[model samples]
Target: MFQRGPGVPTVEVGALSADAYLLDVREHDEWEAGHAPAAVHLPLSELIARLDEVPADREVHVICKVGGRSAQAVQFLNAQGRDTVNVAGGMLAWAAAGLPMQAAPGTEPFVA
Candidate 1:
């Protein structure tokens, strides 16, 4: 689900700190279905308009269902001079790695 591109930075889920700043760039349904417990929601569709919601002081870990959309978000965030890294293998790998995830209160957690 992940790919190595020429320039955008990437990191595995294991490398992240327990409290790392995670940004979920998936669509609304994808996010609501399941997401990292600590992630901040900012769908790629609304990224540009919500740029200020992303942080500049701390490194941002961007993720999506797989890696495609996150790679795109990382590229854009990097170009705009933000410290961002694509979460390699995205949430699929995250789930496979047995990391914690959450869904809406009435739903069970799973990768969307």
Candidate 2:
């Protein structure tokens, strides 16, 4: 189980939806390697500046290489009044769960 931070929530990586408002917060290199097939690529470095792009009404699932960055993002976004959850175990767990992923064009798929 994940440590809950104040208002932040968490969901198992296997339970995520491809159609939900999934946010990938990994770095560019990590993203370039591969990511959730339907996730929106909004690196954490750009999250604050691009906060407007995140839907305030929807429950957002934030993910990174591991749960750390997404957990931090969940904390921040929750403070901003956006309903967010950390994708527990992140990409590694997602891949382990046999979830679909997409890599950069011409590259082999692998979780970064």
Candidate 3:
């Protein structure tokens, strides 16, 4: 399994603003259902091919529906020398925390 460095900081939804980059690793449909405001969608399936989309200078927070995929993403990005953090508990936790979500245009909602 992948692991982050000791004492890596994680931002809660309430504390997140526009300072860092939010990378959503969920599938297309899941992302369309709901996601953090200003989050950039880069489905796990396409991450490897689209790494250039992420800016290296800023903090990147990886998120998925729960947490698994985001963990994987963090591992991959870290291996590539990119600074990334996994959003523990993922979007589910974000919703539980009552964070705001926006519908991604042109995408269909996921039933599950």
Candidate 4:
């Protein structure tokens, strides 16, 4: 059986708490295009190498362009005993909710 951690809880954008740590697992280009305002860019490719950067005490909301990569990431993190949850529907859902997206510092607004 897959055991879930105590802190991690998957939630929709509308249900996400402002205080939660949102981990964006999309690629650099995709993240630069647009992402949740509260999200931290940690592209899936580098996640394992940077696992130590994630705080173990806080809940981590993992997200991708859709939900595939995030789901995969959540599984991996869970197996590694890290607290993580997949943000269902991902940035697409967040955008559909009319949530605000922050551009990279000093960069132009994301076109996509």
Question: Per-model C-alpha lDDT, please?
Answer: 0.91, 0.86, 0.78, 0.79
Q: Model 2: residues >4 Å from true position, as ranges?
A: 1-7
* Residue 98 accuracy (lDDT) in model 1: 93
Put the candidates in lDDT order, highest first.
1, 2, 4, 3
- Model 1 lDDT per residue over 1-112, tens place: 2334678899999999998999999998999899998999999989898899999999999999999999989988887889999999999999999998999889998888
lDDT of 4 by residue, 1-112 (tens): 2333444456787888878899998898888877777778898888889988777887789999877778878887877888888887888888788888877788754425
Model 1 lowest lDDT segment of ten: 1-10
Off by over 4 Å in 1: 1-5
Candidate with the larger TM-score of 1 and 3: 1
- Ordered by TM-score, highest first, the candidates read 1, 2, 4, 3
TM-score of every model versus the real structure: 0.93, 0.90, 0.80, 0.83
Q: After superposition, how far is residue 70 of candidate 4 from its true place, in Å?
A: 0.3
What is the Cα-based lDDT of residue 50 in candidate 4? Answer: 92
The list of candidate 4 runs beyond 4 A from truth reads 1-9, 105-112
- The Cα error of candidate 2 at residue 110, in Å, is 1.2
- Highest lDDT: which candidate? 1
Name the candidate, 3 or 4, with the larger lDDT value.
4
Model 2 alpha-carbon miss at residue 36, Å:
0.6
Candidate 3 clash pair list: none
Model 2 lDDT per residue over 1-112, tens place: 2233655588998777667789999999999899988889988888889889888989999999888989988888887899999998999998888888889999988877
